[model samples]
Target: MLRTAARRMQVRGYADAPKGDEMALTFAAGNKVFYDKKVVKQIDVPSFSGSFGILPKHVPTLAVLRPGVVTVVENDGKQTKIFVSSGTITVNDDSSVQVLAEEAHPLESLDRSAAQEALSKAQSELNSAANEKAKAEALIAVEVAEEVVKAATA
Candidate 1:
């Protein structure tokens, strides 16, 4: 039997982008690199420091993202959202944002009760933290978990 090719290729370097007019965005579990699409004029996501928007023609930049909503609006006014467990988003020279997620999915399938329970647990852990760094990390976890739950129920 012949072996099948990888569903997606791992993006190596920025310069190695596919040679075409289309921009690329790659998620870890999917081979799809989101390129030109309608509806979305920009992408706004939560970074470690704060939220920022990535728009067409923006210069290349990179960011460490936190758990939150990935909202997209089509040029025609349609919108969709997904819960990104956690990941890094890289803005290429072409104005495309690549989201490398730890895990990702549509909000519809998330388990609300489970996410709520997890958020509760994380909150309790954060309250019991014995150090500053640990507390901060726990706080982030709580936020991520809460977002997940919200996305699920929203």
Candidate 2:
């Protein structure tokens, strides 16, 4: 009976083990594909609900991304940060993550001075907007610029 119990415990442990050590990540911006089926260790996303970290075997989730940075951690522990203007992140049950972004750029490529100037211009446009639609557009621009500035500084 003790041997049988030990065998059952070993089988359960094997069954409970994670399927894989890494998750597949696909990051796309409009017509451009940044990472296609790339294996990753983790991903940190800025969502409208809040920032969350995704790892292998994460529960299925769909999140609307805010204008902020998305950090992708590769299997080798190297991290890549990309600033996304807006996006939707989908985590599948099969250990895959897909990010569809409206606009995205590497954080290292951002210029702090240029981002600051854009933020100032967006703020000025928001102040001078004549209609509700224009104001809304300017507000979005301001938010994106602000996030860009933050990413550049970081």
Candidate 3:
């Protein structure tokens, strides 16, 4: 796959990017790395601050990501979108972007109807919570479900 991407980059005149001109991206759920260190030209993450795009050599920083879609644009211009259920995003000095998500799945794998149903259930639970703690948890669940539905439809 790397060879294929390199060939496409060469054909597009993008093969001249310097060593540090590309970012290696990793998406992990728990201790499992779903996508490991794939070379990408760009990545967009949904953060608590706001959604933002990262390019190679971006200033090193850490962000708390919200439940939303994470988009990766590869060297060959192929874009992959995943729905992330909250996480932390870290940009390393070596032009590496790592996302540690509580849960994540490719957009194509998402079931919009299921997500909508979950959203409805969670909302109902939130409205009928017996205590503050339960209410908060239900609220978070509803938010996550809503984000999943949005990502699936997007």
Candidate 4:
């Protein structure tokens, strides 16, 4: 079994690391890397079609993200949650997941009050939008701010 193999590797001094089907997750904003190649068990993404999970050896896919939370689960059962304004997720054949977000922040680091204030402001702007384009932009801002609040509160 896996435990026996691990024990043998340890006894042989062959680098006793937990072995599993791990995928590297990279979260980025434009050219800036928010999270480097961190090996994870799975990633929960909020795609336009709904929420989906990506695991190692998953079929290669590209998905448009909505304003919501992206959860990265490590092999040890620890979960990292991030709020993404909007983005695209690319699952490559090599079991690497790349996320390109318009804006993203760790849920644990966000101030709920600030997110609430931004949501209120965006809502007010949306109500007073002068044109269709302006209204669309304001709507997007409202959506992003709402997502931040939801993630922060969760």
Q: Which candidate comes out best when scored by TM-score?
A: 2
Q: What TM-score would every model get versus the actual structure?
A: 0.64, 0.86, 0.84, 0.82
In the range 1-154, model 4's lDDT, one tens digit per residue, is 9999988788742222223577888998753576789888899999899999988877778999999999989889998888888889998777888999988888888899999999999999999999999999999999889888888899
Q: How much lDDT does candidate 3 score?
A: 0.88
Ten contiguous residues with the weakest lDDT in model 1: 1-10
Query: After superposing candidate 3, which stretches have Cα over 4 Å from the reference?
Result: 1-19
Worst 10 residues of 3 by lDDT: 11-20
lDDT of 1: 0.69
Instruction: Kindly list the per-residue Cα lDDT of model 3 for residues 37-151, writing each as its tens digit.
Output: 9888999999999999999988777999999999888888899898888989999878888989998899999998999999999999999999999999998999999999998
lDDT, candidate 4, at 60: 77
Write model 1 residue lDDT over 101-136, tens digit each, in one string: 776776777899999999999999999999999999
Clashes of each: 5, 0, 0, 0
User: How high is the lDDT of residue 91 in model 3?
Assistant: 90
Which prediction has the highest lDDT against the true structure? 2
* Model 1 CA deviation exceeding 4 Å by range: 1-23, 29-41, 127-140
Taken over the whole model, the C-alpha lDDT of each candidate is: 0.69, 0.92, 0.88, 0.87
Using TM-score as the measure, name the better of candidate 2 and candidate 3.
2
lDDT rank, highest first? 2, 3, 4, 1
Give residue 109's error in model 3 in angstroms. Answer: 0.5
Question: Cα RMSDs of all predictions?
Answer: 12.1, 7.4, 12.3, 11.5
